[model samples]
Target: MKTDSLVFWWRSLALLLAMGLLALVLQPFFGGTIALATMLVGVLGLLAYHLRNLHRLGRWLNDPGPETVPESYGAWEAAYGQLYRLVRSQGKSQRMLSAALDRFVAAGEAMPEGVVVLDSQDRIEWCNPKSMQHLGLDRKKDLGQHIAYLVRLPAFQQYLTAQDYSQPAILRNLAGGDSVLSVQLVPFDSTRKLLLTRDITQLERVQTVHRDFVANVSHELRTPLTVVGGFLETLLDLPDMDPASRESQLKLMFEQTGRMQRLVEDLLALSRLENGIEIREDRVDVRSLAQVLATEAGGLSKGRHTLRIELQEGAGGVRGNYDELHSAFGNLVSNAVRYTPDGGEIRLKWRVEDGCGAFSVEDSGLGIEAQHIPRLTERFYRVDRGRSRSTGGTGLGLAIVKHIAQRHQARLDISSEPGKGSCFCIRFPTNRLLEPEELVTSGQ
Candidate 1:
């Protein structure tokens, strides 16, 4: 027994002894009648007190601490031992539950997707950090508040009631930014639900762009194809045509075929450039390269446009695939020559700017509008479709140039004043441009 229990038992025994002694003293003072009455009362009182103490001791001995169990005095030892074991088992179970809950909380917090839990009344019960960040929630203020009331969006409210789990609805961010979010609601327990949110702005943009590209490409190709077909049918029907008419028809057919071929070739080149086929990096001498391209472009222009070359001395060579760099510069020069009016001057310049080589082509031609400048590199995009077709442009030249610049980690900058002229400039990174000695030491 414990010291406290022993002390209690001793005090109880002394009280009983004192009561018995008092009964004996009363018996001596008032003979049998008085003593018997006093003895009876004392015995009854003592019995009641003893019964109460016994009950209390039984309760203490059989207590399962925080847990409750039935008292068993007849088998006190066994009951007491079982009570302790039960208490320990309960404690271990509670600890295990706590640990599991902690782990669950940690996992939920770590998730990139926003997670929120709602109660039976559709009130915000709990939410992870991501959920709070995504929804711009204040836990203390928002807790126990109805989700419908807080969100206030009609679409989301309808989604909750409809229970349509097929597709998620897009929700605008409440955090005051142009952020788009896709939200999904999942039914959990009897009256609980889990809400998931994901950022899909970029994905949505890509999907929109893809849809537009397909429609645009189809329309563009179909228009030319339809024209070619009609012209071919006309030529075939005129079996006895004059030589001049036949020659004209054949020339028209040839032009259409050439246009289609150019479009196909440009498409293939752009695809290859985007598909990550590694290209050999070599020192590209912009000065000599620009001169050669100018010569070729001059011939292609048929003396209709004047080509001028300005190469800065010691302009330092750029490190890139020579063919791709050549193609990029060639496209710019060709486009300039094609767009400029007859006898118009087309300037090709190469120079070192801010520790990097900058190659620019400026043409006195119909310039692009400011709004169209941002999307000028989009494949098959043209400001003036009629002019582009007339010039035999595949509409992929600038797109190809943009891709090549990206591959070589170069920056392309375009500046144009409508009707004044346009300049297409490509600036190579400093590391990509090396001194002549460095190039020579690296075996060119």
Candidate 2:
């Protein structure tokens, strides 16, 4: 068969031939029976040698390691050497394959999305940690379990049965709590599949918010547009209408247009604030700014309410965009003026508390409920829609204030009790506060 085998057999045959020749010589010297006995002994010795080598080979095969290769003489040596080389090569190849498999597993573990490998029968073969979290699967307990049984959503089951994986399936409120998952089945090979899942909860929230915002904007604009359009149509129809009636209609139209204009301006301001525009780091004079806001509040109140301004001595300035801070402060003061009843007191204060500069607008108004305070900064959120519209509020003021506070690395703290009054404060961090001495030095 093999060259090594052939060499071994040839050597055995030569030895036998040599023994036969010796037997012939012995037959002449001794008797025929003695020569035959000598030949039989030679054959038995050869058999014993071969049996010993075979036993060694068998032992080595049972546990073949680098250091466990059996030593041999003649043709057996060559055979053992070949086997040793083959075992070492196979060991090297197996180590490389194991390393590659480990790297692939590590990569899957590091991914943010979930990954589940399924067998031909849709049974769980393996899954990464993220997949376990997304799908609520346990590696030890859930291995070999069918995917459909674990994810019991009817839509997912339908998608699986349909076998048309062209588009991904969406599951909302998965695990019963506002979690959205996008599940997709991919057939990677003939007998297995890849079940990929991505958590799109935040994405879904953003889309919902976007839809609500568009609808709200449309609703807000539609009323004023309808009013203006109606009045225009009436005026066009009544070409020879009385001057007094014409004047009244025009005034109403003008007010509606003004309201629309304010809404658009507030919408634009909110967009600019949310779009991450670069802010100017101006050292704003809070004392002078408070005085200006007081004056403006007095004008807005128009003797209907009492106004008070309190400034902390040596409170100095805050470092931020002056325009944004002014707008935020103005919004708080204006809202106070609008909501506070006649004879109600409105106080504007600039002070330092806990090593941080703080500006607060305290108002004696119809205070907000505790639940409404958390979402007060959401765009177009109103506590009383009718009163908010009547008071000329765009409903985006607090949202603007929030973005401004965030830009300046500040916190907006709101505290209010029903019928007691509301206090809205923007607290600047210690780093953003310029003390009196620092301001004076900078001025010098």
Best by lDDT: 2
lDDT of candidate 1 over 37-117, digit per residue (tens): 776787787678667646865776565463554443322434344556767788899999999999999999999999989
Task: Note the residue pairs that clash in candidate 1.
Answer: none
Residue lDDT tens for model 2, 170-215 = 9876678679999999998897999999999999999999999999
Best by TM-score: 2
Model 2: lDDT to the true structure: 0.91
Global lDDT of each model? 0.82, 0.91
TM-score of model 1 relative to the true fold?
0.76
When summed lDDT is taken over every stretch of 10 residues in candidate 1, the lowest stretch is 70-79
TM-score for each of the candidates: 0.76, 0.90
RMSD each, Å: 6.9, 3.1
